[model samples]
Structures are given as structure tokens and as C-alpha cells.
Target chain A: MSQPASNAKPIILTGDRPTGPLHLGHFVGSLRNRVSYQDDYNQFIMLADSQALTDNMDDTNKVHRNVVEVALDYMACGIDPAKSTILIQSQIPELAELTFYYLNLVTVARLERNPTVKQEIVLRGFERDIPAGFLTYPASQAADISAFKASIVPVGEDQIPMIEQTNEIVRKFNRLVGKEILVECKAVVPEVGRLPGIDGKAKMSKSLGNVINLGASADEIKAAVKMVYTDPLHLKVSDPGHLEGNVAFIYLDAFDTDKAGVQEMKDHYTRGGLGDSVVKKRLEAVLQDMLAPIRARREELAQDKGYIMQVLKEGTMRAREVAARTTDEVKAALGLSYF
Target chain B: MSQPASNAKPIILTGDRPTGPLHLGHFVGSLRNRVSYQDDYNQFIMLADSQALTDNMDDTNKVHRNVVEVALDYMACGIDPAKSTILIQSQIPELAELTFYYLNLVTVARLERNPTVKQEIVLRGFERDIPAGFLTYPASQAADISAFKASIVPVGEDQIPMIEQTNEIVRKFNRLVGKEILVECKAVVPEVGRLPGIDGKAKMSKSLGNVINLGASADEIKAAVKMVYTDPLHLKVSDPGHLEGNVAFIYLDAFDTDKAGVQEMKDHYTRGGLGDSVVKKRLEAVLQDMLAPIRARREELAQDKGYIMQVLKEGTMRAREVAARTTDEVKAALGLSYF
Candidate 1:
């Protein structure tokens, strides 16, 4: 069961739902990690348009348009298309086939018990009205991961249960079929954790209007920074301000290159005299520096929609090859290989 | 919206889970109608091997073996391969793809509310532990029907909800995607309804050990008839027996050639003096007469597994063409037709 880890390059599966453009939260969470991972791992970046439709079924135009937006985000963030397979989820029919097979291995009770799915259902106010696709997406996610035989899935802390569910399916499938055809994936939680909303909420989301998209222009970036939440009670510049739960400090901690300056600012604020405007100005400058190049690349990529579509088309073909190989193995295991 | 009744042949979709050989119950409920329907419509007979895994996930070998058993049953029952397509559901990848897409249109609450699925959950003792595949199967069935653009689906009374669910998805997809890519199917409920088990249970199922297989030999037919439930109070031949709810009379009503003789026998039994043994013997003979040719045909077909496989492979290819066209339309409607 143990392959020599030193010899084989481990596979990493990661993707985003193409419901909206990539945001600063995405950059801090998974996109940035994907950039460097291309050099070391067998990486497959999926534009999850199908999974996006799980909840956004009525907003398919958004999903369709965001496929390119997400691709542009990846290209702008230095994720070399040549080094990674950037596939569209719906384009790989094999994933849907595999998902159908994997769906059998999971129980409705288990899906209901999935913390991420459960939380999302409540968050979306779906309660009992959650779409079957939305509830069963963990199985689909498992299929997506196992189709490429991914050994590592970079996910958030909330998505750990999904990884557990994937491994359970892998084990159940292998045990029942008497063949270890699917690989179990480990959740590689990024060190940066979650970047909070500009409103100081725990999550940065488009629905909450707290997100600064990676593709934001200079004006949009400034406007978003101006709305950043800070010490509301600290009315006077000389008043001692709360450093904890402050969005400005948090953004600075995440994006600002000047660590010593950030600490000095924090110390002055805690002691007495750092103003919100001064701190906001510094945070805005840091964000502008980080986003300026990405925004420019996105604009350039937008001009060549044909190339992005080609990349996805070619990558989807490549992904289908891998997924088809896995599905064939699965079919053979289950004695469904009629051909 | 209404296509002419004369110009185009309406399509009918029907199938069975390949869990066991077809039984007399299946014959009375669906198979007999399917045979006659071949001339009136374009028919697709699917061996639902994939759908069978929703509950029988650990029994792949059973599913594999029964696929051939089901094909043999179809052939033995006079389902002409030339007039109707005999497809294995798993062989058509487009069905799974379509299922994934339609799954987005149905909510979990709707699945939970499906009467057939609800009853099945209780019947299978699944309760909260229902397999996700089982819960989501209505969507899969919708896919199976719509992939062929099937206008009519022949099902039992209990399956009316399934057809309704299929129509809902079809309407939802066509409405949301702004394209009439899918056709809603009408459920054609057969008049015979569910055949009772030999033990007098309302449903005759293979798992209940009460069914006579369509390919039962004369000896098997005799043995099955001997165990048929008769009136418990009719201990003596002269004792008055209940005509209704008697399994022997039910089987006679279903299979006996002489309707007048059967009616006379029923009257005699209700009026007393008709022995249970006498009725059982008559049933045994009638069943034997009906099953003999089917048994012979099945035995002959059983001798040619390669031919059966070839038939399925060819039928699957044909089925794929239809499913692929539908999926392509769905993709184009969803704006996923990148090519």
C-alpha cells in the first residue's frame, strides 16, 4: 500500500466554483498556494462550473462567464497553464459517471452529517430545500479528486469532513470491489487560513459585499479599502484603539510587506494615536501593489478569450483522459467493462 | 407544442433492475405491455444495472450476472431486438451526465417527499441511512427517460410519482435553460396492476421467495403453485372458500386461457366443493403452458452469452447516440458547449 514517496510526485487536486471572479480571500486561501505547487506536484485545477450549478442552477450565465474569470485569475496569479491541467468540471463527462458510481458508496445520512454541507445548507437558508446536487456534491467532489488519483486536496478547515467522506468512499469502493482503484486524499490545509471580510466578518463573500476581487481596478480597490471596518469606538486620533478584530490590521497582516512598520502601527494604535485613515491608506497601498499586476494580466487575458477557452478545452481533454482511465478501472472493478 | 400523433413514432422508455431474472410479477406488470408496445412506439428496454447498485452496492457480481439474466428474460419474453433497443444503463455514460445535470434542478425536500422513495426507504429499512444514490435515483430515472426523449414511460401505479418527478425536471430544465431540450414523459399504468405473491402478499418480489420466474421450468412452476395461498378456512372441499385475496385464483385470473372456465371455477370455489389441490393443479398447468416456450427460449439464449453481449453492446451504442444528442442540447442550453 505504501509507494516510495520520494520517487513519485504526489498529485494535488484543487478548484473553485465559477460563480464569481476570484477575490482576495481566494488568493489567500488556495490560489496562491496553487501557483507554487505547479512546480512540485501533479496538479489539476478545475473550474467547477458543474458544482457551481449545484446551488446556482438559475444563474448558469454567471457560472459560464466566471469560467474565464477564474481562468484569468489563475493566469494572473502566476499559475502556469503549461505546468497544470486547468479543466472545466462539466466538460469531463467521466467525472459525472464516476460521481454516479461514488454516490452509491455514500449514504444520505452521511451527506446530511457532513459539516460543510450542513453549514452551507443553513447558510444558504436551504433547510429542507437544498438541491440534491448541492447535498451530494461531496460525492461529486470525491469523484473529482479520485478521477485524477489526487493524493492531496488543499481545502479549508471546514472542508476536512469532505476529505474524510472521500476517503471513506475510496475505502468502501476498494473493499467492496476487491480492488484498490481509487486513492484516498489528504487535506492540505493552507497556513494562511481564512481571510476575513472587509466588514470584519469571519468570511469574505460576494453575497455580503465584503470581497475585493483579484481583478479589481485601482478605483475599485480604493473604494473597497475605504469601506474596511476598524475600531468604531475610537472616535479621536489620540484614543487607544482595539487591535483585535480590526479588518485594517488583518489585511495588513495578510498583504503588507512591511512587517516592522505594521507592528509599529499596531503598537501606536494600541498605545494611543494611530488614526484609521493613516492605517487604511497603508493597507490600500499594499493591496494596490499586490493586485495591480494581477488586474493588468486579467485585462490582457480578457482580450484573448479564445486562448483561455482553448486552454480549458485542451486541459479538459487531458482531464478526460485521466478521468476515463480511472472510470475504466472503476468499471473493471465493478464488472461494468462490457467492451 | 403538440407533435402530430401520426407523423412521428412516440418513444416509450421501460426497464428493470438486473437484480434477478424476470418473474411472473414483472410479466403482468410491465413486460407483457412492453412486448405489445414495440409495434406502436420506438421502445428502449434498459437493464438498470447501475440503478441496482443504489441498494446492492456490495453485490457487483450479482448485478453483473443478472444483466445477462435480464437480457435473456427480455429475449425469452419476445422483446424483438430489431424493433426495440435493449440497453444496459451503465453502458450509456450520457445518462449519468444527464443525471448530474438534472440533479441540480430537484431539491432534497422534493426527494424526501417522493412517495415511492419514502415507501421504499421504509420497505428497505433504510430510514435515515438511505444511500444518497437511492435518494437521488428519481433524478437518475428522469435522466434515463429524457436521454431517450421518451414521451411515454410504462410503470406500475406505485411509480406514478417517479414519472411526475421526471416531468417536473423536464419542465424545470426546459424553463430554466430557456430551451425545450427535454421531453416530459407520461406514465402508462398497466391495468393488471401488481401481481400478488404466491403467499398472498400484494407484491410478488424475488427477495420474498414467492415469485415464479418467467423462465421457470415445468417442475419449478409446479412446485411454486403447490405453495400458493388458499383460504385458511376452506379445510374441506365442501367448505365455502373466499374467491378474492386467494393467490391461486389470482394467478388463474392472470394466466388461465379459458376466461369462462376460470369464472366458473371461481364461482364453484366460493359456493364450496372446489378443492384447493384441484385449483393448484389447474394453476400449475396454466403457468407451465405459459412459461414453457419462454423457458425454452431462455435456455436457447443462455447458450449464447456472446450474442447477448453483442446485442447489449450494439443497443448501448444506439442508446448513446440518443443520449449524446440530448446531452449536447442540454450543454448548448447551459452554455457549456465550448466547442
Candidate 2:
């Protein structure tokens, strides 16, 4: 008898901290990619409110409301519920139990050595009194992934170490229990690293006030594009400009459809012929056109707040089912399950 | 309109790590006192399987089965379920979530500095590579107390700092949330410190091979009593014996009836008229009578293992209701509650 064919489609787990609404940076970084992956993989998109509160513990009110806003952004960005399962982290009690068990498999020093946590501590300036939640979040993330038995985790290149830590715990847990109850996930890095901000910073961030929101109005898009930073040396109509560090050209590369025309515009700018105002106007039109459909969908979603909340409520229930089943297996493997 | 009356009957929370069957040491240190508190306070007896797994993670089968065994011991010891809530720690998902939140309130340095933790580290020889779970257990204990709004935590004197840490988090959480959502707890140190082992060691422990389990057979009790440590300086029947450091006398003081006779026996032994054999026989009789009902009940309970399991299943369900409500309030205060 021939063996049954192994399931070919991979399971994908990805999420965002419900700290704010989605912006253009999120669109370019992961959300846009997630829309494409929806058809190829079984996806579980999580709103990591518990992890968000690890650092934003003082601003929980923001996290609480953003859970709905973030889910709405996902729906508006084309993460179909039929393709992706969206969930709130704290709603799944099994995740919390799994996290507690995994904490035993890792050491304090190892957590301290986690690159993502080290970078975050420096960025957040939590010198001596760092919260224990912040230090042990990698374990929490491990619980998040392993709870769904997700085989593929979409994360940035800088976050590969987090996947490493998760896989380490997965291996240790399976070895200790003598069963492969948990799945080890690999980090799927995107083709693009990160999109720069309108201010031309290395990365776009809401806290920096340089992000273009996914739901920007036409006038808002125009205003953000107008403020885009370019080479300061290109002062005159005929000045030779550098496109290497120009954010306007980068946006065009990331969003514009007329690649040949955009390249021609870039060459003209470098040859000291294209005026700065003329190039800015071209970039503005491309960005506005690219943002039009997304803005339309966001506005449509915004009109029905009740429907958006329903999506979250339903998704959270669905998520809890998968989470509960996974936790049952995990606790059974650990011999901690009473029922 | 008057203010809501403060809840008067002080709430008492206590538990045992279900690593093994309850022994004579547990009876003297806490269980005996719990039997009395049932009438005067709102009491909760938790079977701490999650905490036991911190050190016994490899022996989960033992931990899982012992949860019921310990609960049976409580029932046999007259810890009335009608007066006290008997629950399992791992079954309460809210406790895990509350522990996750409290982890942020405590610092790594502060956990390392806890005197009881330091002493345990030395005792266990976990110099540098202590499991993160063991390191964070005080925070977990804090969650256990605060989850029930427990006002009186019955612990040994050595555990005073743990209660202090719990109160610290309670105060900090209330101050940070700008609401009195958590209540500070007071430690109820029992009148006695600890019961020494049959070998006359400082403490009775399962690994130490000196414990007299509550369910020991009569012959086993006789054998254990025969091995009781006495003053070696008194070699003959007429030789004077010292009673100050005798562990047998301490056990008698804590467990035996006929205190006047026990005191007379102590004086007789020290006055060089009584021998170790007479004292040993008397101690054996008192212990046998004390444990007779407990052993009988334990045997009857052991005959129907399913019945014991049912008790825990029902208790855990009841415990989760209270825990869920408390966790909701806690998450709301921290701003992490998505609902």
C-alpha cells in the first residue's frame, strides 16, 4: 500500500503588536507580503496585545483599542478571513500556560543574550530596571508560534534570532518529553528589508512622525509626499541631483508601476536637467495612485465599526479553538493535563 | 448611603507542592493549622503542580498523579471541602495570565535578592544556571495570592519575604493603575517553624529518606519510630540524656497528645531514669493513633482512583471561575484586556 501523501501546504504564523494602526511601512514590510501568502499557506495572524504590554504596560488603553484598529487594517489590506485566522494573544489561555512551561527550558543568561531583546532594551533605554516580561518575551513568542504548530514564521532579518530561540525551546521540549508535540518554525525573511520614511530616515516609524498611514486621504497623501526629503544640494532647476539617497526615488521604486518612465526621470535628475519640483510632482502622482484603492477600502471598513469588532470577536473565538487543542497536546506531553 | 463593608473574614491561601504524598512534616508545618483555619476564614488549598515542575520538570508523570494524592491527603486530614476550596494550580489559566503580568512588576535583580530564593539556591546547588521558572516563582506565588484577593497567606517564617514581595506588587500595581484593583496580603507565620526528619536532620524531605508519609502502614510507622535519633552521650539506662536539641521531643511537642505526660516523659528522660526505648514506644503509639484515621481514609480513597480524580476535576473547574473574573479585572487594570 502506498503511504498517504504528506500535506504540502505550510502553516504560516505572523502578527503585529496592537500599539497603533497600520502604516505604509507595515504595508511594504509584511502586510503586503501576507496578502500574497494567504493563498499558499494556512495563516494565523495574531494581535500580540500581551507582548505589546510587556513594554507598553503603562499605556494599556492604547493597546486595548488598537486591537480592533489593527484587525480592521488587516482586513482592509486584503488578509481574507477565509485564508487567514486572526487572533488576540491574551484571549488564548493555553498560550500563557505554554509560555510558563517553556520558561523552564531557557536560562536567564540566554534570554539576556537574545539580540532582539538587547536591541530593544537599548532602544527603550531600560538600563537597570528592565521588566522581567521584556526579558522573557522571546519565550512568549515561542509559545505563540508553537501554540498553533505553525511551521513558517514571517519575520524580518533582524528577528531571525528570535526564531532561533523558539526552535531551541522546541527541540528541548520535544527531547525532554520524548515526543514531537511542538513544531519548529523557520523565519521567512521578505525580499525587501524595510521602507524608508518620508523624512528619509533608515526606517519608517509612527513615533518618528514620518509614516504615511494606510488610510490617508488624498490631501493627506499629498501633504506627506510634499514633505519627502531629497538631496539638499539640488537647489536650482538645472542642478545635478543625487538619486542614490533620494527617498522620492525609493518610493517610486517601491510603489510606482511605470518602471521605464521612472528610470528615465531618475536619469534626467542625475544629469542636471530635471527640476526638483517636476520630479516631486511625478513621485506624488505615483504614490497617490498606489494608495487610492487601499484608502478606499480603509474608508469602507471605517464606516462599520461594529462589523470590524465582530470580525475580531469571531476570529478570536476561532483562534482559541486551535490554541486550546495545541495546548492540550502540549500539556499532555508535559503530563500536566488533568482532563 | 454607606461605603461597602470591608470583607471581614480574612482570606487564607496555602498549598503544597504535589511532588510526593503528604508526610508528617506537612502535617505539623501547615496542614494541621489549615484544618483549624477552615472555620474562621475563607481558605483555598492549591495543589501546586506547576510550581513542582519547576524543579521536577523531568518527572511530570509523578507530578501529575501526585496532584490527586496530595488532595486526598488533605481530605483525609480533615481539611473540609465545605469550608475550604481545594484546587489545582495548573488548571487555573487566570493564575498563569496574572503571573505573566506580575512578571513585569518584579525586577530580575530583586528576584535574585530574595533571601528565601538565595537560601534555596544554595540548598539546591543551582549556582548560576537556575531555571527561569524557579527564579520567577515568587512572582507566580504573588499571582496566586492576589488572584484570590487573599488577605492572609499562611506560610512559614522563612517565607515572610515572599509575602512582602507580593504586597510590593499589589501596592505598585494599584498605584500604577490609579485604582485599588489588587489587595495587599499579610503573612501568617505559624506558631511552629519546622519539623525535623526522623534522622534528626534540620528538615523532613522526600529525597532525604527520612519522611514518615501520612499513609504509611503501621509496621512502617513502627520501623520509622525505632530509628528516631537520640542523644548518643547517654549510653546506659541510668545515664542522663539531654532534651534541648532532641528532634523526637520537638515532633512530640508538635504532634502528640497528653502534653502533661509528654512533658513528664521529657523530664524523666533527662533525669536518667527513662531509656530511649520507652520514649520511642510512646512516640510510636501517639503517631499511630494520630495517623490511623488518615491512613484508613487514604486507603479507602485509593481504592477508587477515579473518585479522587473527579474531586480534582470538579475543584479545578470551580477554581477557574474565580480566577477568570480576577484576571479580567487585572488585565483591565493593566490595559491588556482586549474584551
Candidate 3:
């Protein structure tokens, strides 16, 4: 996160949780948007390993190792570290301190009312035993957004509630301080957000294990395409297939550039002659073509983890300074600066 | 917050919320014990301004100014800054980071079930609108205790649950790490752990405004003694008085050095030959004698606020080093260290 030195670009804050390696779903949903925003906006891409530990506390070593994996995936997916600051959340202690103060501005009931947090708790099956971190992550998210004074956050439809919660905290903080020191961020919902998983889950989350990683090998990609959810009624080559809810067609729609060819296949499949294996072959070919270079780049970047860490170190050092300034302003507003 | 040398002194973690000046109740409850322990125990006395803002978010400036007032009270009451590390909570960012990780180990249901927090929510009339910080403060307190690896925590009967919560978090972290990196602390409940307010409200607290501050002027102490809750049935000079729950008698019992003389006065009051005015005169005298030197010392210290801040700065700088080491260990335990 750089200073706003006469640059009119609004800061964009977005990142992955680093629970695992990046996936096709991540590519279409956020990584691609991050790449697009890197040049036009002052981008701060975060590897949110600490936030990932809220539910993954059982496997912290995994979180530790995935920082590099996510960083590698970001680089492989065209997120230029020079243009977008790629920071590790755990390295920036100011965010935690910022969250400590922001926590007082929001009520426990408000956090419970956050639709995104509620959905997350339910998804994690933490019903009555929700970790305090999970419930208060929205405040932490708000701290991340306000620490950089980010005015734009790229998120999917399900995460719109998170943006609302961040703005609420911003408004409450400003109202308490009697000044607008924190900027409210708006969600940049991409047109191709929320890519369904290969197994047809609503979202491709790590916990569900239904995802195909961006670094998936050709064999793994082939297996995933064969297992892609499609119409069960059309078992024979002569039987007509329904296009609705077909994961293969959805993948083609999202990734394939040959629109007319895909349309021809959809028509043939809808009529009564296209075999399921034929459609699977086309989907697998498209996915292989898309992920082969990314896989190669990821392997190449993975060779030297030291360079990945150095990039994170430099980014975090710069981000630490920006976040420290924001925290100082917040403390001054609260009259908490003792010295 | 000093390093544990070959001296082999068990560490004590204790502190006060810098909401206001220390009162007579504070002197009797914990401040006296803190002074006594400074010689033999490795003590870290914290001014918990961050925790104070949990419910007092609107009056942050009060919490800020009172950090010095509390430090003054600490010094005035014989807590030597040379022996005790008197640090400010907000100055140690490591504690906040430690608390961020500790929050993942505690559950929302567990925090909700804390008896002290429940009582505080009811006392503050924050039934449904409890601040998230207020609810999560036990986690923060655990952070404070574990950050020092403190084995002794000076608390009252009301705070036994807090000690229990701290130990629970410690055990959870140890269990997750498969080793006991965090030591559980035992609560040292002083003999005079709690003192009744002047209004006989069972407890003297800043929010209740029923306290006679240690820095109270002679006239203020006298007025407070005059308003002290006494036996209402013994209004006449010839009526017998009940000493139980009588705050005037309680103060005399706690502060008066001449035990035989106090017993003589109690006998006369029980035998229907003493007036409330007469007993109040003696209680006022006892309070005045006890508070005179403390008030003078507090006044002397108040003249140089810079010295008080300097004490905090030096103490906090030392404390920051200790806590940073602890946080580094915790992060290492969680395998979150990147560089």
C-alpha cells in the first residue's frame, strides 16, 4: 500500500484466505480481478493466513506453508507484485491492533447479524461453539479495509454483507470521532463471480474439497472433468441432455473462448446425439489449455521459496508503515495516545 | 515484565483499568497487595486503557487522562516503579497480536458463559448491545497473563472466573501445540479482596461513584464518612447499633490500627451509648490519617506528569521486549513464522 501521492486511483483491498492453493474458482472470482486492478488502482493483495486460522486452527502448519503457495499462485495468475502489494496478514501487527479498537465500536449482536459471518459459522458447523475470532472477523476485515483507506473491495455476491459490515464500522468510527477519518469501501462484484465446483457445490471452498486447483495436473483435470456434475437422466448417447445445471457447460461458458463452437455443442447436446464423454473431452481440453501455463509457472516459482518470502517481506514492510499511520490516526481520534 | 534471570522469582500479572483515580477501596483491595508483592515477586502492573474502552468507548479521553492518574495512585500508594514494571496496555502491540491468536482458541459460547462478563453486561444495562470488545476481553486478559508467562495473578473473589478463563485458554493452546508453552496462573486472592462502597453497595467501583479516592481531600473524606451507610435503626444516641454491613464500622475495622480502641467503640455502640455522629467522627479521623500521606504524594506526582509518563515509557519499552519474545514463541508454536 503506497501513499496517495497525487494519484487519483482509489485503493482496492482484496485477497485470498490461503487455506489452500488457488483454484479455477479463485481465478475467475478474484485473482483475475486483482490482476486487472493492479495497474488502474492502488492494489493491496493480502495472503490472509491469520484469518484462515479462525477455523483451521487444528492445522496451523498448513496455513504457514500455504502462504507461499498462494503467493506463487498470485504470481502465476499474473498478479504483478510490483503493481499490487502482496502482504502476509500475520506480518502486519497493526491490523490486529486496529481491530482491537474497532471491536469496541461494533456490538456483539451486530456481528451475529452479519449474514456472511452467520453463513460461515453454519458452514463450519460451529453453531453454538463458534470461535470468537470467527464471529469478530468482520471487524478484522473492516480494519484491513480502513487500514489502507480502501474505497473499493472486490468480492462475490455472498460477501456483499462483509462490505456492508465494513462500512458500518467506518461510519460508527467516524461518528464516534466526529470526523470522517476512515473511508467506506464499496464491493466490485465481477460479472463472472462464484464459479461452481467440479462436484456442483454452490461454492468451491477448501473445506468442501470439491475444487480443482489452478496448478492441477492434466490427469487430475481429466478426472475432475469426468466427475463434473451433469444431467443424470441422459445416460445414453441418444438421450437428450438438459443444459441447465450442467457443470461441464458452466465451465465451458466461463473458460472457453470458442463461443460458437460451445453453442453448437450445447445445441447438439440438447437435441439427442452428443455423448457425455464427448462433452467431457471438450471441457477437459479447455481446462488443460487454460491451466497448463499457470501450472508451469507455479512450479517454476515454487523452486525458490526464498524469493517468494522476500517479495512478501518487502511488501509487508511497506504495508506496515501505511497501516501504522492509520492506526496512529485512529488512536489519536480516540485520544488514546499516551506519550 | 523484566527477563527472568537466575533470581527465580515467580512472575505476577496484575493491573487496573485506567477509568479513574484509585480509591480507598482499591487501596484495600489489590493496590496494597501489589505494593507488598513488589519486593519478592516479579510484577508487571498494567494500566489497561484498551480494556477500559470496551464499555467506556464514549469517554476515551477519560481513560487516557486516568492512565496518569492511576500511575500516580500507584506510586502514591507505595508501588515502586523501580521494583514493578508499570506499563500501559495500548503501548504493547504484541499483546493485541497475541490476543488475536488467542481469540481463535476460545469459543463465543464460552465467552458468553463467563459469570463476570454476564454480571457486567447486566450492571451496564448492555443486555443485547454488548460491545464485541467487552465480550472478548477475557481473551485479551488471557493474552496479558500468558504474554508474560506469569504464574501468579492477583485478583478478587469476583475475578476468580477470569483466572479460570485464562487457564482454560492456556490449556487449549498447550493442547493444540502439543506442549505447555503457556503457563496457567493461580489467582492470589488477598484477605481484604473486596471492600464495601460508602453506599454499602457490596462493591466499590468507578461506575458506581460510591468511592472515596485515595487522593480524596480531607473535606471530601469527611463528607464521604458522613454519608457512609450505617445502621438506620440506631438513629438515637441511646439505641443499640448492628455492626454487620455497617460501612463506617467496616472502614474502622480495616483501617484503624488501634484494635482495642476500635473494640471499645464497637462495644459502646452495641450497648446503646454511642451516636452515629460520634462513630462517624472516629471513622473520618481514621480515614483522614490513612489517606493524608498518599494524597500529598499523589499531589506531588501530579505536578510532574512528564515523570509519570517517563516511568510508563521506560516500563513499557521493557515490557514490549518481553511480550514480543512471547509473541514470537507463540507464532513459532503455531508454525506461522515466515521470516
Candidate 4:
């Protein structure tokens, strides 16, 4: 579905917390989708090192190094520097200023009510002594979007509340200041909210030990595919098998181009004829085809790490100009313009 | 009493909120004292427009204009650009970054317990809807001090809690980061916490209609002196009078250089021999002597407003270098340095 013609080309801001390298789940869920939006919208792919350090404060050296790794992953996954502006969060001071301004628009009570933050706090087990930075990240995210004048934010269903918070700040800022200083943003919920892990877990994550990196080699991909979860009930080669909970079928549904052939295989498995080994081999072939070009691109770019860093530096410089101009307008709206 | 090292002058960080022009209370309590500190220690005076906008967000135009006014006030009051670094707060984005980092070092509960903020909330009558900026200002103040590695912070006795809050953050940051990344600032409480209003009120403020502007002309000064409060019980010239609660004596104690003469006059008045008019005339002469050169310098500087702005711009640029360097060191310590 597309928006109305009167609506501007939705400016999109989507990024990853650079805790580690991007993985296959990220490819299917967001990164690959972002590559498609590059020519269609004003895109900003950020390396959120500052946000990552909110939880990884004690291990900031890891965060610092991962910023480059994540940027490389974005390039390897087909996010174009010519179309999409990739920025390091720590390099743009305007984002920090915008965050400070938006902090006033939110309350402690309202921040505590954020559903995503609430769940993450529980998941992270920071019940009593939660880091203030982690709690206020939603406000910081609002700043990131509003700083770029981003009108469309691509996020999962779990992150819809973050968009709500951003729009709330936009409305409040405009109303309080008697001007449309900030643009309201919409949440674009992706078709697939999450991709399951190789272990058949509900989510793919670094901590889960099931994520396959975007830059994984062909051999590595094969090994990972070998461990892909299949039906536990099926014992014999000719045994009637269920394909519903089989992770191999899920991967086929998400990544395969020939859906009809995949459906036929699934039906054959359920009809008491096909074996799990044949299905696993076909699923592995489809995944390899999907990741082959990406892996090649990652390898080509990884040869000269300096070139990747240069791309980031150039993108950051371009991003900073836009950010600075937006900050000036914001400061003007707030009557903070000095000259 | 002085510090242990007699040759070592205390480093001071003091500033105005830049909401309005410096008035008589500001002149007597802080501005006059800042002039002398230029010769003694490393003095960093700031025009705190960002902090001013916490409460005055609606009046940003005023804050923007008053930044120059406050800077001019500093220069006119003899805060030498050669000896003191005068800067604007919002111009330095590093302060915002430091504030963000310092927020992690402080707790919401600890911020809520700040007595100064509590009193301010009551005074501002923002009981439940206290702006988050207002609540977190102590942390921002910590950034302001720690950004400069300020060793002495000149403040009133009522602001002791704010100093304590800054030191707490300093200690916490050092402990958590495992490095002495911040410096602890001592509060240099002035002998006179505040100057009483002309009407003998406990404090002089712009809202109280008792302030005399530092830029007041001779006629304005003469007219303001006439309103100075004296002993109400001394109905006749010969009647013995009380001087303890008198506003005129407070000003004399704070401003007058002829302490022996002023003491003798106070004794005469208490012994039922001196007239209130005589003491008032003496106080007027002493104030005019103190204010005459400042007013003349202000008049001279006002004619060349461009020159004053240039001074401010130059000082702001110099101050930014220090702040930027300090911020780089801070980011490096936090391992957020992109470079």
C-alpha cells in the first residue's frame, strides 16, 4: 500500500544498535527493506553507538569498534551511500541537542509507561537500578527522527510505541511553541516483524547463539544450515511429517523465490513421502542463493577497511550538513538563534 | 579564612541565566565580586541561556537578546576578557554531551531529593508539572562544571545542595568509568548570600520591583536611593533606631569601603544622636562612587555595541576550544570517540 500523493515521500529513519555485526534476521526484517527505500525516500541509516552504550556502558570499546562493523554490514547488504545517508550518532551534536529539548516534552511518568522500554527493562533485569539513558532512549529516538525531519520510521510491531512517543513530542512542540517546527512521523510496520533463529527460537539475536552473520562464508552458511531445526516427530525417511512448526519451511517462506516449488515440497512432506534431509538441502540452497551476493559484497569491501571508513566519513559529513541546517531551524523556532 | 596555599587563587565558575539585565542585587552579590576574580584565578563566566530557557522557554526571544546584555554586563562590570573566559552555554554542544553522560551518573530519586529544586518548584508553583529540564538542571550544572574541570563554583548558601549533587556525579563517574574523568568543584559561598531589596525585603529580584539596574543613569540611581528602607521606629531625628533589619545598612556592609566610618555612623545612629537622612546621604555617596566608573564604562561600551558583541564572540570562540577539547577527552574516556 502507498500513501496519498499529497503526503511527502516519507522520509525514513531506520537503524541498528551496533552491539554486533548484522545477521540474516536483520537482512530479512529491516536492512534489505531499507535498501529498497533508498531511491524512494530520504533515508538515514544510523550506527547507534551511543544508544548501544546505554546497555553496554561497561563495554564501550566493543561498541566503538562495532560502529564500523555495522556500517560495513549496511554497505554489504546493498544500502547505497549515494542514496542513503549513513551517520554515526556520536558525531552529530544536533541530535543530542534535539534530545535535550524533547526530554522536556516528556515526563518521568510517561517514560515509565513506554511499553517497549518496560519490556526491555524486564528482559534486561534492570528492575531497580535501571540506567536513565536506557529509559530515556525513546526520547532520544524521537530526536533522531525529528532531527532529520523524518516522516516515516520503519520499525517492528513491538516498536510502534516509539513512533507514538515521537509524534506526541512533535505535536506538543508545535502546539507549545505555536508553530509546526517538528514534523509528525508514522510507523511503517514491516510485513515480517521478526525472523526465527536457526535453533527455531522465536527471535534471532546475538545472545541466542543462532544468528548467522551477513558476512558469513559459504562453508559457515552450510554449517549453520546443517543445524537448522526440523520436525521432531518425524523419525523414518517415509514417515508423515508436519511442516507447520518446521523452521526450514519458515526460512523457505521468507527467503525462497520459487514459492510454488517450496509449497509442493511441503505438501509432499506432509503426505508421508519426502524426507527431512531433502527439505533441509533445498532450504539451504535457497538461503545460500539469497546470501551469496551479500557475502561477496562484504568480502570485497572488507579487503580495504580504510575504504569503508572513508565512506562513513563522507556520509557523516553529508548527514551533518542536513542535521546542522535542521538544528538552525529548530533553534530559530525556539528563538535561540544568536545571529 | 583563605585556602591552605596563599598564592593559589581559587578557580571560579559563575554566571547569569541571561534572562534579564544585571540589576543592583546581581551587581552587589556576584558581578562586583567577579571583577576581582579576573586578577586572582582562572575565571570562566557563562551566559547560561540554555539553563535560562528551562523556565523561560516561552520567552526565548528575550533569552536570546539578553545573552548579549548579560555579556555586556559582565564586561561593563570589569570582568576582563583577557583574564576571564566568557561564553554562551548553547553554543557549546559538548556541554549537552557531558550532560547526557552525567545523567547516567545521577538517579531520579537523588534528583528528586535536591532541596534547591524542591524550593524552586514551590517558588515557581509547578508542583506536579515541574518540567523535566528543571529537575535535571543539577546534572546539567554538573556538566557545566566538569566540562571546564572547574575547581571553584561561586554560589549562594542556598545552592550548597547543587554543589553536593555535582560532586556526587563526579565521584560516581570516576568510580564507574574507572578513571578520573571529572573534577570535583568546591562551592565558594560568598560572605553575603543575597542583597536585600530597597524595601528591606529579604531578597532583591526583578519581579519584586526593588531592583536597580547596573546601567541606571545618575538620576535613576538618586531616585532609587531615596526609597531605601530604614528603621521605621525612629520617628524623630533624636529617636534611637535599630539597624539590624535595615536594608540601607545591608547595602553599606556589602558595598561600602569606609568600614570604620560606616561603623562610627552606625554607632551614632544607635546612640540616638544621628539622623536617618544623614546615613541615607552617606550610603548614597558611597554607592555613586562605586557605580560612577561602571556606568561611565557602560555608556562608552553601549555606543559601540558592535565592539561588545565582538568581544563576546571572540570570548565564546576561545571558550569553545577549551570546551571542545575537554569534550573530546571526555568522549575518549567513555570510548565514544569516533575518530
**Model 1 per-residue lDDT tens digits across residues B174-245:** 999777778888998999999999999989998888999998878888888888998998999999999778
Q: Over 4 Å off in model 4, which ranges?
A: A1-10, A218-223, A226-245, A271-275, B1-11, B175-181, B218-223, B232-239, B273-275
The 10 consecutive residues of candidate 4 chain B with the worst lDDT sum are: B1-10
Q: Rank the candidates by TM-score, best first.
A: 2, 3, 1, 4
User: Candidate 2, residues A1-339: lDDT per residue as tens digits?
Assistant: 112137756778999999998898899899999999999888989999999988887788899989888887898889998788888888887888889888999988888899999999999988877888888989899999988888899898889999999999999998999887888888999897798999999889999999998878889888998899988899986889998779898988888888999999889889898887787898888878877887788788889988877777788898888888888887788778776
The docking category that best describes candidate 1 is medium
Q: What is the C-alpha lDDT of each candidate?
A: 0.91, 0.86, 0.91, 0.84
Best by DockQ: 3
Fnat (0 to 1) per candidate: 0.82, 0.61, 0.80, 0.35
- Return the clash pairs for model 3, or none: none
lDDT-based ranking: 1, 3, 2, 4
Model 4 agreement with the true structure over B1-339: per-residue lDDT tens digits: 213266755567889898888888898778878887888788889898888888887677888889877777788888889899888888878888788777776766778789999999899987777777788889889988888878999898889999999999888777767877677889988776789889888888888888878887878888888999999998898888898888788788888988998899889888897888888888888888878888888878888978877777787788778788878877887777765
lDDT of 3 at B48: 94
Give the higher-lDDT candidate: 1 or 4: 1
Alpha-carbon runs more than 4 Å astray in model 3: A1-6, A231-240, B1-6, B236-238
Better of 2 and 4 by lDDT: 2
